[model samples]
Target: MYQRYHPDKNANDPKAADMFKEVTFSYNILSDPDKRRQYDSAGFEAVESDNQELELDLSSLGAVNTMFAALFSKLGVPIKTTVSASVLEEALNGLVTIRPLPLGHYVSKRVEKQCAHFYSVTITEEEARAGFVCRVQSSDKSKFKLLYFDQEDNGGLSLALQEDSAKTGKVTSAGMFFLGFPVYRLDQTMNSIAAAKDPDTSFFRKLDGFQPCELNELKAGTHVFAVYGDNFFKSANYTIEALCAAPFSEEKENLRSIEAQILSKRAEISKFEAEYREVLAQFSEMTSRYAHEIQSIDELLKHRNEIHASYTITPFKRSTSKSRSKSSSKENKEDGQTREKRSTRDRPKKKKWYNIHLRVDKRKAC
Candidate 1:
């Protein structure tokens, strides 16, 4: 490049003190192989990372405001600002801005006054995909039907849709879009900006009265439909939008999410029901055991030959020796019977204690 310096120029006047001089400074231009290769292959977005503050042209800024004012005239706004040359200069300085995206309208297919095919664009505060282009989709793209034509073949289908449409298969599209690359030819480096036609292209400039030839192939992101003819072609770029089913698809997504929540809640209720069934089964087992214990206690209480505090003793004489011997046998038999009766009473009393504990649950009081 060059170096900056002050040179001696004035002799007497203070106004002509030392004048600025241009010094030729030698600089070796260097390019890294990795970065150079990436820049060559990447899309329009690749270079924007380093260009934080895009260069502003005063004239282009004025043009953007002029276009906005023309549009607002039909918008029926209550207040309008008067445009002064000085105010325009301030607007051009960056008070108002043309974002990466812009306000767009649907290109009317009415070719009587307007272009035959045009783009219907929805404007919002969002960065548009650079080089965003669309092509006419065919009606019956069963097999890959390749079609291409230049200005020589001015043939284009009216894009007729089918009867059972929107369910399956490509319905006819009413518009056309840039099927090729979307490189912008705006020379922001200069003050003037326009959609530079191919005449300005280097190769097209050299040719006189030349018709451009384009090659159409199945690319990665191209949309497709089927047409009856193998070849029907027109060269001018056209854009249109198909009416998507029920606008605001984001709302539909919210409904789907609500349905999912309902299903999840139902699953939780089912799980609770299953857990309740398990608890009921455990309660049933406990109830069956309590019933068996109650039956055992009932049998013990109803035993006919036993009663509490009653001694079983047979009657016998207390005087004669033979009678006394008989009395001893009677006494032995009575003691054995009494002992058996007492043990039964004590064991059955445990069943009563079990019943008491079984009825101790709070629900039993209720």
Candidate 2:
């Protein structure tokens, strides 16, 4: 159920750590010229490239790797060898584990560009948000619960119904994956570069965008709206239970569990961030310390590019083709009605209520 790349990185970038994380994030392989041709020819085994399934279960990375090795061996493709480098190890450190979200009638779309409901938000502010934005309204008194957690499961925090707009929104359940997201997580990647030009949200498209929602324009207190879609009318309206992560902070123990785990993990990440910063500082220092060395983001990128071009892989077996497969392999069951591609519900369910069970790690107060 994990969507992973064969573990390939572009290998051309100067910063192995940053590039590997970006590549691994896409479930790709790290293919530098120094690695196996089998890795390069085969490329990534795209999981429909619709990462809507569950997060990659982090605990299972080795198991997942073994599974892929078996799958690729069966498919006649072997993983690249550079997968063993420090860059990959670092990226895998952040690899998340999620169950595969189903691909049914659910349609997925990312927010290419969204103007605020009001004008106080500027383009710079919107860019900083780096989040998905969508609105789901249900009028049937059916409640909508929103959940948030880290990209990985290693963190023990899962938050339920954390609507910023609501103060007393109850924390009904934590670790309840099924009741939330009902179909798909918000697509945060800017999928269509062309979409940047058309920044309007029609009723049809807005219902489809599953990014994080914002209630900033509304009154500080609670307000009512209909959460729509998924068999409510021609669509449905769900009564939103709360707004952001602000609704529930009463369970101090769970909060502590979340904070502790995140801090522990952040400590590791912070270590790396510090190293990255130190290396950068050293490079700058070296640029001056050693008169011959060049220093700049551009110069470093070029230097990184040259290293990969000349590197060579041993024990090579080359393949002759590339493939980009889509969920089209799984046909829709209904001709008229779209197949259910994703459900925020952890599993397929007949029950309708969002049983949210989650706790979020507390960040340092800004």
lDDT of 1 by residue, 97-199 (tens): 2212112322222211111221223322221222122234334321111112111123222222211011125443322222232111111212111112221
lDDT of 2 at 238: 27
Q: Over the full model, what C-alpha lDDT does candidate 2 score relative to the true structure?
A: 0.31
RMSD value for candidate 1? 35.8
* Stretch of 10 with least lDDT, candidate 2: 111-120
How far in Å is the alpha carbon of 110 misplaced in model 2? 21
CA lDDT, candidate 2, residue 153: 51
Candidate 1 lDDT score at position 56: 18
After TM-score superposition, what is the CA distance of residue 325 in candidate 1 from its true location, in Å?
41
After superposing candidate 1, which stretches have Cα over 4 Å from the reference? 1-254, 266-274, 304-306, 309-366
lDDT of the candidates, in the order given: 0.31, 0.31
Model 2 residue 311 distance off true place after TM-score fit, in angstroms: 38
